[model samples]
Target: MSKENKHITVFEHESLRTDRGEQRLTNGQLEALQLFYGENGVPYYSLIHHGVRFNEYVGVIQVGKTVIEVLPKADKSNDADRWRNVLINMLHAVGIFDIHAPSNSNLRLRSNSILDLYFELFIKEVEYLLHRGLVKKYRKTEGNRTALKGSIQFAKHISQNLVHQERFYVRHTTYDKEHDIHAILYKALKLLSYINTNVQLNSRLGALLLDFPELYDIKITEALFDKIALDRKTEPYRNALEIAKLILLNYHPDVNRGTNNVLALMFDMNVLWEQFVYVSLRRHKANATSIAAQNTKNFWKPLSGYRSKMKPDIVLNKDTEDCVVLDTKWKNLNGYNPSPEDLRQMFVYMKYYGAKKVALVYPGSENRNQSGQYYDHSSQDSKHLSNEECSVISIGVEKDVKAWQKIIHENISNWCQLQEIV
Candidate 1:
């Protein structure tokens, strides 16, 4: 496969080379990156620099026909499994996966194939849904003699041949285990079955195949999922449906499409990082104020009315006033100072929100081993408000949820001072 056709970036793996080394990004590729910059709630990206060195994220980003390859951070193993767990928890906190759904945090998928991991999560979820029994609906049934299961339509039967069989329109609610959901699952499974390249993928597919019935591989689309509905009785299927939806949505055939053409899938780490913090804070806040992500509000407006609105990442509201506005940056800001643009943006947030405190949070650099610091910028921003304070807080990414949860809780509580509860 041509380098342009297949761009590879794995978390912690050494960056791969294309025919041309470090080629300039195409206009389309830049546009794709921008689209990830915000359009969707999830932007999978970090800045190009971690400290002073270059550190791009991993994944294949597609814009037009061009593919942008980003390698993940080098660490002990790709730890893709662990990252997925992080993503799952993040998603759970963000309200994507069901809170009650079983998590695979304990199960680490031992494969480098992104497709394999995705397929594994998806198929397993489908099995769970199927095991719970596929949802059933009542539809009009005609023809077939002997069961007399539903109400017979005598009028239409009289128009047809003499009655040896009952011509009926009936409602049957039973788990037939055949539906569009299964059709989509079957189609995805069929795609997985043809792969011979990855042993893990092929083996996993083989194992899954035994469990799934021989269903026709039908053409599946997002609309297929839209057509199905889950009621209170089949509420358990929502989690599985979510998993299946992701798989089918991103499933693209790696057809080795000529040298220049490509098939790619990627996520913006920016969105992921923002959501991680916002949701975590919302989940475990010491204050009772409202926590909002990307709240829409204007900061500066001209007399002619060319509105310049500011969108802060996270805001904490008390009563009717904005108490704290926090902006999350996915950078290792252990020793570095905040950029002019960043400080300015936070200034706008504090000024507009009338917030007493604002924070610029970053991930602590791994090698630095430096403890997080608090720089009181209250005096610095006195021009805006003498009492206003801006702090730079860094928190380590803990492997344990409870530990991480505590870390997040303590860090937030440390920054906030709430009034006594009446």
Candidate 2:
């Protein structure tokens, strides 16, 4: 079967759809759809024009050739009342739901929409912590501490008496009226305030200061110092200082610390795979109408001397006759611009595959002509095509989990334009 032979379709409420039609589905799109359906308990199906076999399950769909799985409605709730619960869970699972919500209704509705109930639950837990005192209280009599040593002795006596006295007698005689609920309330408020402030600081770094007061204060001081150092650098530091800002400005420290801990605990391969599929599908939706792939053994024979056997990410079939060869890189491409070597590798891929356009997509960047287009260079080596023969493009992955779908779609659109695939 040729690359153009596989097709998969999903109806809004249908169990699944698979047909070996002329239309081809991009790997990314297929993966995203599968994930969406699988998560929703919808049946998933796929058919390849070639004789490839696939494994299927109740909420999982896999493409035989690519081993791509889709989970539909992973976070969507069939129950209206349970919408918030399901949405919040989904948001957390995808790491896209924001923590800030002004009201319970807002939180509940947004959580349901995003399928992130855990986040809402975390928020509720924080609210509970804020209202409740951290320490337990006990009562003492008015003359309980009259004499220093005698009071101690008397207190001990009372303690024992309390343990053995009948329940009603102990309640009437031993309860202390002078106990300060106001003071306890004040202390609880302070603790809650500190937690709210610090959880925001910790989210970006993926770690939090211990609840010990002295330790937390010390850590905050040290972080401020590091931020100053980072500010002096010529280039912006995306990982450390910026992330610190994100946590401090966006997350509640005490609440977010617990949230991060929970997220770390729940991280798994299935989650990661779903994320990958989501990103890929989003890109495809943004870029091309349809995409297909062809595996060619000894495909690099044309450029054997210059490059090794390499599997192209996808062979895109656009409206134009010129094919687009795409390669997806799961790395940060923004830090360094593509080097001459990078350009050369892409050029080789294009020439070998007979693709007029080529794209090298990094995980989270967009394809833009930051540097001007490469001009074809005439080399004495007859096998090498001039630079003008192929166009190499770079794209970034979407950082916002919520915007993954949109970002991917936009990127794919831009990528197709760059390659003139559309």
Candidate 3:
């Protein structure tokens, strides 16, 4: 397939119409998407009657030869290419991609999709690892050998080696490059070789596969990645291993058809926005202030079973007390009123966390700051307002990520300082 024909770009909440030319997906591709949605709970897209409507998640999804790049769009005027760059910058800010600097020349390439960037980065990591020499670890092995090495299994040795007296069944530990980490990298490389459509990355990927050791395939799972422990010697492989884990875990191969494997490399924009805000604040926070992400507090308890907890996206603490609680929303307000549920939730967070100020943070075209106060039930006068304040702060997105982050930190710091005045 030609690159132009195979690549499709759509924004969040947009539909992939089946009748649209150059944007319609094949039946095989739809089937692959259906399977992926069915298996992955909290799907990124919903199946329409004749199309697929993507939600607030953005990233690349590759089905067979077709690559669908979903970009985040909070503004009506933003295009796919612009939001694509924003998404890439956001990912880099959150440390998802380890690139030192992404140039305009790189982002301007129409031929490169997010998947291509991912493949190229993975290939580079593997190339560096091969240059430094693959790390070897001691792994336990059990098999039949001609010469006796470690302690022999008596039952297996007696049964299997009865006919062949020279053969021995023994369990031994061998120090070699054939370990779980290498196994994972090898698996990711093999997957890339099969699904990658980039012509430029193919030769480099081929060289990586040749240099990378062929290890036995193991079942890829969350637990497998959790079990990995890196020391000083293997620390350099951290970036490569992180990417490998992402690729191996997200890939779902078709068992019945074998051709329409689905690889969904996606991120929830809401979550990403929250993280980006938290990272920005943490990086530029005052010496006395500390920032935490996803702080949970006990909200409700049933007579039996697990208790419910309220987890706010970001919390800022000055010295010891909670200074401000900020909940990040990815949607553009556009002068619309905040949702009632969101206001009530922030109120609960304020009362429970003892935060003097609470804010709902959003992304918008221009910087907006709105402030309000909660009604005090204890006051005899119904019109009396409490000292606790709730504000809506929107930080505008800038062309440069550093400038955008600076705006975020500045706005948030100002919000925190306001609490000190009262």
Candidate 4:
């Protein structure tokens, strides 16, 4: 499908495409996207249409595509493993429903559509939820080979046929599938089937689904889940449910029903990167150190009683005295220098928050990709911080987990000025 035409796609950050040439966000759409970003605090996209510019950074944005259809930007192909893994890991790190999807065969390679990828991963989660404990209830059945399972349905009893002179009874029965976990699983699976039935599936996921016995056959929707109350017994379904609800709700041609109604299943790279950075850093918090995401909800009192918010992205403190404030930007600092607005924001954070140093952490450029180690780059300037200095830290995103952990650890240790632990 042409990008300018209608389609539901999973897009990566700074990745919007256009083939129709000159394009820009319509005034109404521009206001709407920005307003949503402001409320959510996730810098969604950068629009540069016909010399008009807005948002944190600048990029080409197409017109004509409906807000719900274009959905958002598109840079990276969804076919690669990096794209999906990043989304899953970031969601996991941020604690948005803890899910560790076991590495499977070519889930990334086989699936290309947004709907396809979501359902493929989502089915695994549902399979996990149900497999953790197969949702079982006393389902009514009537057969000549087995005993009566539930109360008999005398009205439609078929006792005419006998199997091998029958050692068991035959009767009609009506029983409860319970609308419990089993019903949810059944409905969720049915929803998965509807997501994209025509799309081709990789051998791995197709085989994986067959592992679980079809638990139930029932109709369900987003509302079906809402009415059911879950307790500690069925708590395992929580994480999987959060993901399923989104996929089922927005994984359609019409994301929402009518008039400029755009229900996005997309995430802002800036938001995800910031969350991942903070989550990764917090893993190494020392006994004598403290780290706060978004700075303890602390605001600066610029004019006594007239509170001004000084919400930096991250704050690290050693023994509660010398603190280093850090903020994350999704843009590649290697190609693009830090903007004056970014510098001013950090400067204000350092001056008002009493930070020793403020590091503007950003994703390093793909050109600097290294093997077996993360490429680290920084530009230190003495003018930024009040009496100290600021570090514009950029680290490679393509590194393996252990390498990234080590790289970030070293950066934090040096940035905080804490003595390295042996």
TM-scores across all candidates? 0.64, 0.30, 0.89, 0.58
Question: 83-170 in candidate 4: lDDT tens per residue?
Answer: 4444554554576534545555224435433344555566667656545655444445565444555454443343533333433444
Residue 67 of model 2, lDDT score = 18
Model 1 residue 313 lDDT score? 88
| Per-candidate clashes, comma-separated | 11, 52, 0, 3
Kindly report which residue stretches of model 4 are placed more than 4 angstroms away from their true locations once superposed: 1-117, 132-176, 180-185, 197-229, 252-264, 298-308, 334-337, 366-386, 420-422
Roughly what TM-score does model 2 have, to 2 decimal places? 0.30
lDDT of 3: 0.82
- Candidate 3 per-residue lDDT over residues 243-275, each given as its tens digit: 888888888888879877888888999999999
How many Å off is the CA of 317 in candidate 1? 3.0
> How do the candidates rank by TM-score, highest first?
3, 1, 4, 2
Which 10 consecutive positions of candidate 3 have the poorest summed lDDT?
100-109
Clashing residue pairs, candidate 3?
none
Give per-residue CA lDDT, model 2, range 1-422, as digits (tens): 43422323221132332334433445443444444334443222333333223222212122222112222222223343232232233445455443332355234323211112332334333333333322323454333332332133445456655664432222122432122322322332233333332233224212211231221112233444354432232122222223233333322222322211100011122334335434455344424445654334353345346543565556665334566666554434445666677677667766676775776554433444332345535655566544543333444333354465555546555655643322
Candidate 2 least-lDDT 10 residues: 259-268
**Candidate No. with top lDDT:** 3
Give the number of colliding residue pairs in candidate 1: 11
